[model samples]
Target: MNQQQFEKMKHGQGFIAALDQSGGSTPKALAAYGVPEDSYSGEDEMFDLVHKMRTRIITSPAFNSDQIIGAILFEQTMDREIEGKYTADYLADQGIVPFLKVDKGLADQTDGVQLMKPIDNLDETLRRANERNIFGTKMRSVIHEPNESGIKEVVKQQFEIGKQIIAAGLVPIIEPEVNIHSEGKEKAEEILKEEIRKHLDQLSEDENVMLKLTIPTEANTYKQLIDHPRVVRVVALSGGYDRDKANSLLKENDGLIASFSRALADDLNANQSDKEFNTALQNAVDSIHNASVNKK
Candidate 1:
């Protein structure tokens, strides 16, 4: 990405709506949203419901407003059309940048850490994303505890992957999501911060990178990273928190914004009336936008 494009993304509304649920997680989300398991076929039903949810957000006024600056889309939904217009085109028309989730998924655990499964055909995937006018890409890996060695390996791998994406002329959202329910969350954040700095410190001055991390237990745990010269912006994932709690926590840290999936989509179901769905989306967007502005 060019410097001007990077500035637009970094300084925009900071609240990124994540609609990139993979096949494995989509079924559970559908059920949680009150879609009965036997209502339709198998994975197809799950994706269909996900498509409906994406359509709702894309059609909402709140989503078209400045409350949401960017959105992440699953591969299946990225190219789909709304009202005969491509989803990416619709988002760009509304001034909300579109991002694609490029990681395959998580792999088996090693040393208590779950590494993100590398994309098998990343070059072609990135080429398609670029052709589709995607603004960025996000990939996820998991951190279970504050193991220094494990954290270093995770950081190394993430940065290596990020380098490839950056070289492909697209921004990368490096996500090493810490399990919120794990013990010693505070210590884990400290370790994660150190590992991040270790890799960032080695980067050339022009190699700007972005991070999408789990909310830290303490407000200033990631302050150093937010201020790092090579770090463009720092964003937080909702992890397992609900919208209310997630917003509350997001406000505790300065320079942190949200890239929330479940929290952003909370309370809307396939059964809601149009008015009800719109109300839910508006309330969620308002809260998340307010939190992003109140990050201090």
Candidate 2:
């Protein structure tokens, strides 16, 4: 993501950020990022994530008191592992919001099957959340993977998911992730930009989504899928290693970038290294700084 693109995104239209696998490094990394963190981690890990959220809010120049700090529990919620009744209440107690990752994503179910498959505990689980009063609910779609869909499944799923959430009165995180990881941040950004275009094709006149968990940052393939009219009310996502890239991506589009590491439960190294996450962010900031100095 670059300055021009960053300038284009609508501000305060927050993006979702992910925690890297390091159970401990998130807060320090986000502080280095100069942005607030919104996290998604396991039940045991809330201690660390909440601390990260609080510290980022207190210290970062970007902190907004009105915004939320939260996490997405895909494996736990989908598998019926969370104690939904008190979980939301518990998170609020810690100054964190909780979201149920409603999208079913996996390679085998790629085209259409994934989106149509009802959330494992859809109606009942949300009811539990509402009763307990969790901050909101988020759902995603596994649309256009290795096989792009002319079948129009993303839009179909979008309508279905949006309607359901509206009925339930939960804020929907509509993330249609084409998150095929890449070592090159620019390449990753490319893939994401295209993914954003594809997903946004579903946006209607009313444009019902509360957010797009991931928005494209790199320019590489973004233009390939660029046909949508903006439907996302806000934009954000959580991923590992892209805070700065994520920062640049959102800045270009004039949107928000919420923080998360891809899946820190698995990567012990990334979890511990603040340097890793901040490098891209630092590079991004430096680029802007250099450009500003040059302009002057």
Candidate 3:
């Protein structure tokens, strides 16, 4: 691991930018960016358009290290270049750390949750990410209700993959998101916390990891996890919440910072002028940054 990047990740005061929309989510992401479904006929064209969108966002003055500590990227984006430099290298140049989304998306729901699909060639992926100066990886799983066995299984899979990532010398953002609209949301969070604590306790003193969770039903639900010796940081996923609501809930939790996707891109439109785009992005960044570091 790069010590400088590690120090920045451990101490940085801003949120991470989630720009890792994969094949499953790319169409939705692009449509929201004002590109209709008919705009592209195939996967290649779709990816090209999304890459352009990502490039525009990355190159924008509003997207910078001052308010963004890191960015999580898709595999395609990681392999692509920005202004004659690799995506991760460009982020590093701007003083922002880069991470890759390492999972192969979610498997079919079972046991009230959806775990990650088996990742093929994970070792090769991690090797490539490391070679590109990437500092970490993010993978996601989802829980719909408080099924103890299901939640336990989700966390278990996450840690197992996380250990693999760690062994490859990269931090893993272990994310087991409880569905924001789950009928038994609070109870689910409780079970999720217990499972996470068990794993954190098992980690060696020298091992460090990050957690990405949904904003809990109650404030400070992950307080112990936030302060855990093995946890480097704990970030919150927007999880379908609008920007205002997500930030509002985030303020109620003291240590967690944002790693928003849709919320971050909420007001941005493909047709907006550069000035308008930057203004909108700056407003979102400021609000999220305030909620992150200037707790209510």
- Most lDDT-accurate candidate: 3
Selected candidate, larger TM-score, 1 vs 2: 1
126-197 in candidate 3: lDDT tens per residue? 999999889999999999989999999999999999999999999999999989999999999999999999
**lDDT (10s digit) by residue, model 1, range 19-133:** 8988888877777677877886877766877788788778987686477888888888877787787777778788777889999998887866788886899999889888878
Predicted candidate 2 versus true structure: per-residue lDDT over 101-206, tens digit per residue: 5554433564432454556667776776666554455655543443435225654565567667656856566655544352343443444445455555645554
**lDDT values for all models:** 0.84, 0.43, 0.95
Give candidate 3's whole-model lDDT. Answer: 0.95
- Lowest summed lDDT across 10 adjacent residues in model 2 is found at 1-10
Q: Between candidates 2 and 3, which one is better according to lDDT?
A: 3
Error of 2 at 163 (Å): 1.1
Clashes of each: 0, 43, 0
Per-model TM-score, in order, reads: 0.95, 0.50, 0.99
Error of model 1, residue 227, in angstroms: 1.4
